[model samples]
Target: MKPVEIAKGVYDVGVIDWNIRDFHGYSTHLGTSYNAFLIVDEKIALIDTVKKGFAEQLLRNISTIIDPGKIDMVISNHTEMDHSGSLPYIMDKIGIQKPLYCSKMGEKNLSRHFSSDLNYQVLKEGDEISLGSKTLTFIETRMLHWPDSMFTYLKEDKILFSSDAFGQHYAGHEEFDDVVGNKIMFHAQKYYANILLLYAPLILKLVEKITKAGLEFNIICPDHGVLWRNPGRIIEAYAKWSKQEDCADKAVIVYDTMWDSTHQMALAVADGLHENGIDVRPMKLRDWDRSDIMTEVLDAKAVIIGSPTLNNGIFPTIADFITYMKGLKPKNKIGAAFGSFGWSGESVKIIEQNLGEMNFDLPVSGLKIPFVPDNNGLEKCREFGSQLAKAIKG
Candidate 1:
């Protein structure tokens, strides 16, 4: 993709990562883009840079509008490799002495990431810089996802160069919200669920702070995916997601079966959840990506997990999913565990313990079946599911 002029004299000179499928364990099935912006003024500034190996492409994109050497300074919104990997090459090309502006933490982080000798200028909250006619204000959004993350607001354009707050792992032809239509929200939601769900409390506080500050944005340019031309939609979504409310009557049944016994139990549980007018999604861990399961878990009021016991422990896949889910810290959930076992049945108990650790409301005791669940055992599974529905409704 060529450089897209998002606003007058401001261009999105980022490189598209069309083949990336996994982003630090988060599934990027639709691929993703490493978005970098170039603001051309009397003093040109480049905000962020693409991933490693894409530095030449990033420079090529910049060269389309202006020479890379003409860029007077570089802004590091985030220190993550995906956003700052090209900094060394870029700084060397532009000029070793060119200023590299970033937040205080960003300054520290960049030093750890690369050479400490680079011209580092630390910007704090409410710091402003002049790019000739355009004015850029900085907002310190520490731990929004990373300690070094920050937002650069172009006051003249009403555009917020958000580092990763409202980003999606999507690399498509559509570059703007209005052009991508409503489907972009899925990727955004998935991104939020898998990457930012653990920071719900911080996100809520950040949104409130931004609201009180009366910060209005005409466009939100994230470090990945499409730029939000309809900024209100993404903001509203962030507000809703950050709350982590279980307003939707949905349940996700995630399971991994060894001998099809746990799979049978999962279906019976889904039947019970469905009978009570609840939307049910039965996902096999082996078939569905952990990231996708998390997306379903985002709005679901209940998360029912089933796994067959192996060597007196939970299935490996089950354990993997649990670890992944635990780190994300999903909130406001009713959790239930069920499984089949031939000898010592520890899977259900292990899952319950994990759920308890996550603060999930375990409304019903775990259901465990011996070897294969008989007709009566399956009925118990349905009953267990029905009880979960009642608890969710209550």
Candidate 2:
């Protein structure tokens, strides 16, 4: 696809990889792109670069418009190899002594990956760099996804160079969010649920900081996805997402079973929840995706976890799910656990232990069916559902 002029002097030179099926082992079922931007002010600047293997193509794309040597500033928004891996080669090819810019943490990461001698000009929070015609202002957004993360704003254009925040793994030549439509929202949720969910508090702080800074951004150029022309839409949406608040009247029940006994118990619980006018999505851990469940939990008010005992422990898949949830820190929700065990009957306790370690304020209600779940045990599962619903409602 031809590189398109996204706005005046702002070009979307990032490539579309329809052939790519996965990104860093995360299944990008809808494909993705590495978004890079070029800003032409008095001193031309390349905000970020692309992958190392695509160095040749990246240069060729830049060559079509302007002399690579004339690029006066290079900003490394993220030190993730995907974004900054080509910096060494790009600098060598252009014979550029122009300073590479990033946070101090980003500089450390760059040194580790490339070499100690790789020249970098580090900026702290609220630092500014003059581009002759326009000024680039920095805002340190630590742990939005990485400690080294940051955003740059062009004073003249009101454009925010957000590295990963508001980014998606969507691959397309379309430069605008309105053009991308539903895919933008879908991939945004996928990206947020998997990557930025845990840092919701930081994100909320960032929103407040940006507003308090009075940075009027009309354009948003993110690192890995489409640029935003309608800045308010994204900003308003971010305001809600960063609050760790649910957006739905639904619940997600994630369970893993052995020998169909625990599975039966899960189904009984789901039936009872549905009977109580709750929208229940009962998922089996065998093929349930952690990221998918994360997206579900992002909007869910209640959650139910289940696993069958395996060697006096919770099932491995269930364990992995809890680990992911804990890392993502899905807050502002009520949750509980259930399982079936033969001997030790420790699966529920283990699940509770994991939840407690994550500092989740889970209401005290967990269940474990002894041996096999019979009709009587099914009643217990239904009762657990009732307790969970009551907690969620309260």
Candidate 3:
């Protein structure tokens, strides 16, 4: 894949990461792209940079269209090494005299990560820069997943150059809607749930600002994944994601069963969900990867998390899962609880309490079973599933 012609003067000089395995801390199960854009005008600009290993390929790709020394401005949207890992190398090849632009926080972060001397010109919210006929506007979107992140707007073309806001880890030959079917939607939602769920508050604020600013963006050139020429799809998807809504019209049941009684209950719950025309994906906590569960949770309208009692508390693995989720603070998931306990039923209560602390700001109803899932216990589990489905429907 060579450089993609995104617009008349704007080109996608981004690198396709088909072989790369990991991203940030999450497993890039399907691989991801480190998208960088090149805009040529009276002065040339490069938005974002590829991963460290891809610096040579990135530079070669740029040379195919224009000279590397001609790049007058380089935009660093986020200081995270994935988006800026190749900055130092690229700057060395392209010369250091060019002006580098980023937010103040981004500047501080970049200095901390690389060398202190590599400071950049700081741009704040509503700042604008000109490149011949087209003007670029900066919107401060701090914590839209990162503290120093910001998006650049192409004023003349109505194209929003988003760094990672609308990115996906999906790598494929397809570029737009006509290429793939609904797989794009699935991959996009998975990326949002695992990556952007924690920054939902800031996401809502950013969307509102974009709307209030009255910017007519005909295209969204994100740093990764496919470009959105049908602006409505990405915008509507962002609106729904900002609100924390799932798309599968399904439910997810995740449980860690010690004996096998709890596992049976989880399957029963899945059955209830299926009978009601709701698709269900059940996973044993020990057998399933957190990232996979996270992807399912992203699209699930309902979620059921459970664990068997262990030594007066919840299962240690489940406790770890809850702790991981606590920092993540995934939103827009309506959930329920189910677990089996011996003499004391502490596991169910513990799971629910942990989820509450994680700030799971969604409708919830909990259920707890005894030491085993007898006829009555299974019935109660089915009832919990029904109630959860009802909550999701509302």
Candidate 4:
């Protein structure tokens, strides 16, 4: 992508990856962008860089506006390879002597990725740097996802160069929020569910810190996806998501079946939830990706998982989903387990145990069938669903 001016003299000189399907195991079906910004002032500064393999594309984009060598300083917002993978190459090409500004942890992290002798200028929160008409203020966002993350604010322009706070893994041509409209929010939700859900508490604290500091922005330029031209839109969205309290009056039934018995049980449970006036989504493991399922779990008040026993243990796919979900640490959820077993009925007990470990409100003892569930067994599953719905309502 060529350099596009975001504001008066600021340009978004970033590279778009239109074919990347997987990002460190998180499915990026919509691809993504490694965004960097360039400011033209008395002292020109480049904020962030693209991934390592796309260094040429980044440099080409920069060339469209001005020679990259003329850039007086470089800012490292996050040391993640996707954002800072081209740091060494850019620094080498544009005089390694130029100062690279970053947070204290960024200095340590980047030095490990590149040569240790490169120029590194560390700045703390509230530090300011002047570039003629525009001034940049630093805000340290420790563990907003990474320890090295920080945001740069253009005081005069009222723009916040947020590193990764409100980013989405969407590779759309539209660079502004209003142009993309509501569709951008779905991508943002998926991004938050898959990437930032585990850090919800830290995100809440960061949002409160920024608000208390009285920082205002006309635009929020993140290191990925589109810029938030409607500044308050994403901030409001993040604030809601970080609280983890605004869940839909819905339930997600996630399961995998060996012989369709578990699938039938899942459907029965869905019927019960529907009867209770709760929105229900039944996802067979084969038909849904784990990341997509996790996104569904984000706004769901309850998660009901079913699995057929295999090798005297839960289905591998269900095991994988449980591991992934547990790591994400979703809170304020009610959970229940149901499944069919040929001999030992251990899967339901195992699921219930895991959910209890995660601190979910478990109201039922879980339902288990010895073989293909009979009509009576299915009714029991429905009753289990009704119990979960009641818990959600309460």
Candidate 5:
């Protein structure tokens, strides 16, 4: 993709990573983009850079609009490799002595990332820099996802170049929120659930602080995915997601079966949930991506997990999913465990212990079946699911 002029004299010179399917651990079925912006004024500034592999492509995109050497300054909003991997090459191309601005933590992280001795200017909260007609104000958003993260606001254009707060791992021809319509919210929610859910408290506080400070934005340019032409939509979403209060009457049943026993139990449980007027999602562990299961877990009021015992422990896939989910620290959820076992029936107890560690409300005791769950055992599973539904409704 060529350089897109997001605003007058401001270009999105980032490279789209259309082939990337996995971001660290999160699934990017639609791929993603590494967005970098170039602001041209009497003094030109480049905000962030693409990944290391795309350094030449970033320079080429910048050259399409202006010579890379003409860029007077480079801004490091975050020290993550995806956004700052090309810093060394960019500085070499522009000038070794050019000013590179970043947060105090950003400077430290960049120094650690690269051994080169480059110009590093540290900025704090409420710091402002002049770029000819445009004035950029810095807002420190530490731990929004990273310690080095910050936001650069172009006062003249009312555009907030957010580092990664409202980003989605999606790559497509559409570059703006208005063009993608409501479909983009799913990707954004998935990103939050998988990446930022652990920092929900911080996000709520940050949004409140920004609101009280009377900061306004006409556009929000994140380092990934489409730009938000209507910034309020995303701001409102962040507020809601951060709160984690608006959960639906939905249950996600995740299970892995060795002899189709746990699978049948999962289906029976789903039926029970649906009969009780609860939306249910029965996901087979091997069939669904962990990231996708987490996305479903975000808005679910209850999470029911089932797995067959193996080697006196829960299934390996079940353990993997539990680790992933616990690390995200989902809130306001009711959890239950169920499984089938031949001799050592420890999977349900192990799952229950893990859920307890996450502080999930275990409304019902775990259900365990021996060998294959006969009709009576399946009925017991359905009753367990119904009991969980009642707890969720309460």
Candidate 6:
């Protein structure tokens, strides 16, 4: 990706990872971009760097506008390797003697990542640095996702350089929110569902703090995906998502079947949910990615999981999905568990326990069937779904 000027002298000097389909464990069907910005004032500053492998691309992008050595300061917004992986390389290419600015925790984190000693200037919330005409304000956003996370605000430009907040794992030609249109929010929602869901409370507090601070932003540029030209769109989204409210009267049935028994139960559950005037989605574990399923769970009022027991335990796929969902910590959900077992029918019990740990309102004990579910067992599953739907409506 070429360096595109987002503001008067602020350029997006970042690299696109169009082929990266997986980020950690999150599925990135649309890939992603490691966005870094270069602010050219009387004193040039580079805010964050790309991934390690994309160091050359970052350098080339910076070279398009000015010499790497000309950058007076380097700001490390987040010490996560994705954003700071190329920091050492960049500091080496430019002069290592140049002042490196970061949050207090960012200094410690980045120091551990690189062995070399360099200039480290630690800043905290309410700190401001001058670059001739423009002033850079730092807001310490610790634990939005990481301890070292923070945001840099270009006071002159009214652009908030949000390190990882409001970022999406999407790779596209468009660099601005207006250019990308509606598709941008899909990726943003998925990102918030998977990566930032656990940090929702902190996000809410942070957004409130930003509002209380009266920090108005014209543009919000994150360390990934496209920049938000309409900054409020994502801020409003963050506010809504963080509240853990506004769920639909919908249910999501996630299941995995060794035989057809659990599959039949899932279908019956979906049918019962639909019969009760609830929007239901039955997702086969083998067919749906865990991240995608978590995204569905984000706004759904109920999550019903089914699994065929395997060796006295829940199916591995079900275990995988439950573990993944447990970490994301989606709130305001009701849940039910269903399963079929040949000998030991512990799958439903275990699923119930996991969902309970996530604070899902489980009104009924799980339904377990022995061997392949007969018509009677399938009917039980349908009853369970109807009961869950009634609980959701109430």
Give lDDT tens digits, candidate 2, residues 170-235.
877678898887668877877888888888888888898888878897888888778888888877
Score residue 133 of candidate 1 by CA lDDT: 95
lDDT of 4 by residue, 1-394 (tens): 7789988889999989999999987889999999999999989999999899999999998898889899999999999999999999999888899999999999999999899978999999999999999999999988878899999999988999998889999998899989998989988888899889999988888888989988888999988899998888888888788787968889999999988899999999999998998999999988898998988899999999999888878999999999999999999999999999999988998999999999998987788998898899899888888888888888
Higher-TM-score candidate of 2 and 6: 6
Q: Candidate 2 — which residues are off by over 4 angstroms?
A: 19-25
Every candidate's lDDT: 0.93, 0.80, 0.80, 0.91, 0.93, 0.90
Best candidate (score: lDDT): 1
Q: Would you estimate the TM-scores of all the predictions?
A: 0.98, 0.92, 0.90, 0.98, 0.99, 0.97
Per-residue alpha-carbon lDDT of candidate 6 for residues 1-394, written as tens digits (9 for 90 to 100): 7899988899999999999988998899989999999999899999999898999989998999999989999999999999988898999899889989999899898888895487999998889999999999999888879998999999988999999999999899998899999988989999999989999999999988989989889999999899998999999999998898978899999999987888998999898888998999999989988888888888899999999888889899998888888888888899999988888788888899899899999997888888877888888888888888899899
> How many pairs in model 3 have backbone atoms within 3 A of each other, for residues 3 or more apart or on separate chains, i.e. clashes?
0
Q: Evaluate residue 7 in candidate 3 and report its C-alpha lDDT on the 0 to 100 scale.
A: 78
lDDT of 2: 0.80
Candidate RMSDs in order: 0.9, 2.1, 2.7, 1.1, 0.9, 1.2
Those runs of model 4 whose alpha carbons end farther than 4 Å from true positions after fitting are: none
- The regions of model 5 sitting more than 4 angstroms off are none
Off by over 4 Å in 6: none
On the 0 to 100 scale, the lDDT of residue 326 in model 2 is 86
Give residue 216's lDDT in candidate 3 (0 to 100): 89
Report the error of model 2 at residue 102, Å: 1.6
